[model samples]
Target chain A: MDAAARLFSERGYHGTSMQHLGQALGLQRGSLYAHIGSKEELLFDVVNQGAERFLGMARHAASSGEPAAARLRALLVGHVSTAAQHLEASTVFLNEWRYLSPVPRAQIQAKRDLYETVVRRIISDGVAAGEFDPGVNVAMAGRLVLSAGNWIYTWYHPDGALSASAIGAELFDLILNGLAKEGPA
Target chain B: MDAAARLFSERGYHGTSMQHLGQALGLQRGSLYAHIGSKEELLFDVVNQGAERFLGMARHAASSGEPAAARLRALLVGHVSTAAQHLEASTVFLNEWRYLSPVPRAQIQAKRDLYETVVRRIISDGVAAGEFDPGVNVAMAGRLVLSAGNWIYTWYHPDGALSASAIGAELFDLILNGLAKEGPA
Candidate 1:
């Protein structure tokens, strides 16, 4: 699975062939087919695993019973950590999932939408509790958070200066406090 | 070029073939070869065009003689608008540029680095002028800005509720002001 994820990330889903998978695994075509159904199956498995990881983190954070801000922080941290730890899978998940056929594609899309909804709900809760600015655009705020979190897969390295959690925390701080010295004005 | 960009974006650089490009353009292989050298050339052309659009926008913003915040806003808006307007090319540029051969790859990387530097300089200037929070992590903040801007190509549509500029402006407001009601806590 890891090898498959790596190839998919490097060569793209359509570009990676079953023959290539066999070579990567050091298996003959017959042996490879004995274990896996098709290239699409591998693609689906890799993409599905990634969706689950993201959705799992979001779900855990949503149910953590923490305040909205804390919950959001946890969610972002978990998300970045997952992407950093599973870099190849995350890359394939983020970039190649669109190639999934209709049924599986819809399944992944549902999970993705659910994840966004969870993030938005956290922001909405923050707004309702007066913890976040009442004037906040919940949807846009949610997109910004997800965007920052999602793009980490492109640049993050485990051996880099910052850990995944630290990256998430810094982003969380920026999202909550902003860049302006006076905050807004 | 448009057909090539669309194919490259949809099928990926490695997955797309000369035959596919020829078919998309309603040209025979001979005619396709008459107009283009190879798949790599098309890839480089598309990626380079996208890079120029992005760098052009950032350079324009950087040289605007405006305050850091205003410059940053113009940069973000221009970045988002470019991505939204050239969705197919932007998608290929962001996702498939890595498939370029080493020399062209380095050229793209250089432009990308310059773009990041431009963004970071805006934030650094803001901090130096006391317009932004002195505690801001300029690198992370720049990544956050670029991440938000880059990810728009995945979801933006010409017929969407908000125009590209409006979406960029809303994100600019969020990035500058934050979500916390009382700011930074």
Candidate 2:
């Protein structure tokens, strides 16, 4: 699965073939059939693997007994770290996820929605607790947070100067602190 | 150019052929050569077109002589609104931009860097003027703003009940105001 992800991310899905996957692992084409049915299956495997990591992070954060802000930080940081650590899988999920079959796509989307719902819940709690501003729209805020986290796939390299944790902490500060020179930014 | 963008974004670069493009516009494959010389030209044409829009927006904002915040708003709102309006071209810019040849790729990249540099200068000036937080990281913040604006290609739908300007305004407020439920969030 790791090899599959690495290959798929480095070379696009269209650029990869069953034969290439076989060659990378010193296995013949026929042997690969024992492990996977087809090309789409490999793509699905990589997507599923990446989705699970993100889902687990969200679930853990939601279940944790932290305050809303803390939970949000955990979720955001977990997402950034996941993207950094599993760059290939993360890239595949962020970029090639549209290639899944309808059923698999629905399943993957449900997981994604589940993650968003968790973020929304935290935002809701934040608003209710007056920890967040009343004007913060949950759906839009959820999308924004998800965008900020997921878009890390485009630039967050493990080999990059800033570590994932450092980026996460800084983002946490920015989100919690805002950017405005005046009031909370 | 718009027709090519629609075909390429709806399908993909490698997934699109000159004949497919020809078919989309009801033209014979051989005749397409009269206007478009080759497959690579379509990719470059569409990318170059989108880059021009983005660079135009950035140029306008940088020259507006407004305060940093107002100019930043113009930069953000202009890019996002234009992206939403030209859905197909925006998608090509976001997703299929990698298909350009080395020389043209460098050109596209240069335009992209210029756009980023424009926004970075705004943030830097704002920070220096004490209108933005002194702690602001101009480059990272500019990229974050760009990423947030670009991901609209992945999820936004024109008929989905939200207007482009409204979405841009909401996003601008969120990024400008931030998510923190704290002293300044």
Per-residue lDDT for B123 in model 2?
A: 88
Judged by whole-model lDDT over C-alpha atoms, candidate 1 comes out at: 0.93
**Candidate 1 local lDDT, B107-145, one digit each (tens):** 999999999999999999999999999999999999999
DockQ of each: 0.85, 0.59
Q: Give the top-scoring candidate (DockQ).
A: 1
Candidate 1 DockQ category? high
Where model 2 places Cα greater than 4 Å from the true spot, the runs are A26-28
Instruction: Pick out the ten consecutive residues of candidate 1 chain A with the lowest summed lDDT.
Output: A176-185
Best by TM-score: 1
Interface RMSD of each: 0.9, 2.4
TM-scores for candidates 1 onward, in order:
0.99, 0.94
Cα error, candidate 1, residue B41 (Å) = 1.0
Summarize candidate 1's per-residue lDDT along A1-185 as a digit string, tens digits: 89899999988887798899999989998999999998888999999999999998889999888899999999999999999999999999999999988999999999999999999999999999989999999999999999999999889988899999999999999999999998756
TM-score of model 1 vs. true structure: 0.99
For every candidate in turn, the CA RMSD to the true structure comes to 0.9, 2.0
The Cα error of candidate 1 at residue B38, in Å, is 0.7
